[model samples]
Target: MNVDQIILQSVIAHRLDTIAQEMGAALERSSRSPIFAEACDFACGVCDHKGELVSQLNGIPILAAAGSFSVQAVLEKYTGNIQEGDVFIVNDPYRGGNHLPDIGIITPVFHQGELVFFTVSRAHHGDIGGSVAGSYNTRATEIFQEGIRIPPIKLAVKNSIIDEVLDLITYNTRNPQMLKSDLYAQIGANKIGQDRLRTLLDKYGLKKVKESIIQLLQQAEDLTKAEISKFPAGSYTGEEWLDDDGFQETPVKIKAEVTYEVNQVTIDFTGSDKQVTGFVNSSLVTTKSAAYIALLWTLSPEIPRNSGAFRPIKIIAPPGTVVNPAESAPVTLSTLHCASEIISAIFKACAKAVPEKIPAGFGRYCGPSFYGIDPRNQKFYVGFAFCCLGSGGGKKEQDGFPYMAPISNYGGVRAPNNEANEVQYPLLTLNHHLEVDTAGAGEYRGAPGIKYQVQFYGPDPSIVMFGDGMKIAPYGLGGGKEGSLNRNQLFTKESGNEWLKSKTAPRSLQPGDILTLFSSGGGGWGNPFKRNPQLVYEDYKNGYISRESALKEYGVVLTTKGIDWNETKKYRGIDYESRYNV
Candidate 1:
């Protein structure tokens, strides 16, 4: 190709990426749900006519990577019926969806009557009603109890909204008006994508744009392969476990065997545990998306995450395993686990190959979704306590960020703003501050856990507790100490304060009931004794660690003036000459 063609190719790629980003921005600003508008728990993507992902703006990493699957499902179902101005929606895990709560809206972009591209948006709603008030029904045994499932269907035809379909979906969810408004926001976001993509095509012409996309795809494939070849040829295995399957007393495992040969790689989940009776199962597409993001994290940051980026990496998720469950299985909490265990497992499996790139275990998501009648407005309100979100794992060069949604989110889903949340819900935020001494001890300390309390003032709200990191804390790596376990408790005037389960069906709450959430700290990386004593002293000064922890965990003796290096050396069992070496 000539220089002009190369320049045009770069322009086309960035234009498509910008279009998807615009879609994301639109959704965040217009969506009604706090998770969508405030937390930004959504993803947007632009796809080729064939449903091959071209460019996806990163929102939620797992959700962004899985957008292509939803588009492909729509294409397969609609076939020739797909036309200009028509929009499609799907949220059935069996039919290329992440889960029930994450609904996807797809729109076809046509230029002068010929289909050219697809715009897609997938977002997690606040509530998709099921057996319980919140969607994370731990007692649910089947998908039916998880929530309402919407298969690949036309949400709009020829730019005309289908009122009955909208009514049916909103009718089932607890927050009908919120759901309806959020759905419309998704529709509007996709519409923006369609318009922007059409503008790009008009400027560059269809023929050149098609050539550019082909070159872009090939470029991504070549870049990804180049990165894969860097890994040493070997078959490495790693395993992770959930606290339990919500119902079982024993933990459930998700194992990974990663193989790197030449420029190709394969991830197999042959020996993972079977599907459980709880809602922790991962859908096939969700599994693939999780693996894809894990690989992307270790690969060259420049590699475009288009369809071709995954050409050299093949995923084998065994049927009926926790990685790929049956159609009827409940899978409401799969997204949360992607960061906690699945992605962590893959990172561990490839640690020997990419030691510098892989990070330690992230604090798993262990929050609750609560709903009740708002006495202030005489209406029902549903809210996600993302304030219970944990911190990130430690990296080689940097400490993990505090109070992140999950590792799977990659900072896309930020912690809910306290003031914004209070305005949206009928709850008072009592505390949202970091808890000192909760970070795992290592060369680079893991992020510290936090204390979050919310006192509900409405009548009899139900709280559905789901997620891990309670019984089993985030795992440490490279001789580092493990992070502290998560703790959930309910406080009331009658019942003083009682511990809550990691996974339970549903519990009713009285007015003025305070929910206290103590989230898990991120796992640390490397040995603690090797950490810089001065840095440890700084941590003590900043109140991140107590004086006792500085001495016990880091073997650092804090003095009135500065660190007592002589005492530190004695505590670490190393002489003055050898103190810095280890």
Candidate 2:
């Protein structure tokens, strides 16, 4: 290729990326729910006519890849019926979707009466009608109880809205107004993407545009392969476990064996447990998306996230397993819990090959859904809060960030503002602060978890807690200590505070009842004795760790005269058995 062609390819690639970003901005500006507008739990992508991802804007990593699968499903279902000004929507896990709440909207772009490209948007709806109020039925045993599942269907045909289809979807969800508004926002974003792509096509001509896309994809593939070749060829095994399947008291396992050979990687989940009776199962699309996210994080940050970037990666999770459950299995909580475990397992395997690139374990998942009726307005409200307790262990150079969401949803699901949340629901947030001494102990301590309290203001509110990392805290690596466990409790005026289970059964909270949540902390990395004493003193001064904990956990003695170097050295040298007298 000549210099002009190379320059043209770079310009076209930048244009495609800009189009994806514009779609995201449009969705954020038009969405009604705070989860979409404030939290930004949505993804926008531009694909080729063949449904292969070309460029995807920043959002949830899992949802970004899931959009490609959803577009492929639509293409397969509506082969020749696809035309200009037609839009299709899908949110069926059985049909290439991540879950029921993550709705996907796809639009086709035509130039000169020929299909040239496709634009897609996928967003998580706050509530879809289900057995539970927030659509996250932790106790659900079957997929039917999760929520309404919609297959690939044309939401708009020839620039005409399908009122019947729209009505059916909105009527089923608890928040009808928000649902309707968000759906339209998705449609508007798709239209914007379609127009932008068409303009580029017209300016560069079809042949030139198509050639540029091919060149971009090839460049991404080459870059990814070169990065993969840096890792030594070998197989590494790693395993992770959920607290339970929300049914039994026993732990559920998710195992993976990752193989790297000749610039290619394969992850096999042959030893993972079978599908459980609870709603923790993950669909095939979700499994693939989770694996892709882990692989993407492990590789160099410079690689472009296109279909070609995933060409050299393979994931094998047999059907009927927790990672790849059957159609009948419940999966409402898969993306939150199961997908997190999968990512952790892959990270553990990669650590064996590239320890410097992988940090210690982080908080797995935390989702607390609250719903009740407002006596003042005589209306029902469902509040879905995706809170993060803490981040993973520190890297070689820096400590991890606090209250970070799971790897798959980084920067996408933000904590809702306190004032906005109170105004939207019939509840009051008493406190949302970091818990002291909850971080794992190491040379560079992990981030501390958060502690929050909420009280009901109106009628009895039903609370459903879907979380993990209770019985077993986040694991540590390189001789670091494990993080603290999660705790959920309720304190009522009539009844004193009582501990609640991780996967608590739906129960109503009386007026003036307060619910307290202590999110789990991240695991630590490296040996604690190697930590700097000045940093430990700074942590104590900042109130992150109590004085007693600093002495016991870090062996740092503080007094009115400052550091007691002799006592500190003695404490640090004492073995665990000798110090504790076990």
Among these predictions, the greatest TM-score belongs to 1
lDDT of 1 by residue, 269-369 (tens): 89999999888899998899999988777787899998989888899998999999988998888988743578878888988677778777777888788
List per-prediction Cα lDDT, in the order shown.
0.87, 0.85
Question: In model 1, which residue pairs have backbone atoms overlapping below 3 Å?
Answer: none
Error of 1 at 446 (Å): 0.5
TM-score of each model, paired residue for residue = 0.97, 0.95
Query: Where does candidate 2 have its weakest 10-residue lDDT segment?
Result: 573-582
Report per-prediction Cα RMSD to one decimal: 1.7, 3.7
Provide the global lDDT of candidate 1 against the true structure.
0.87
lDDT tens string, model 2, 333-361?
88877888898899889988887787777
The candidate maximizing lDDT is 1
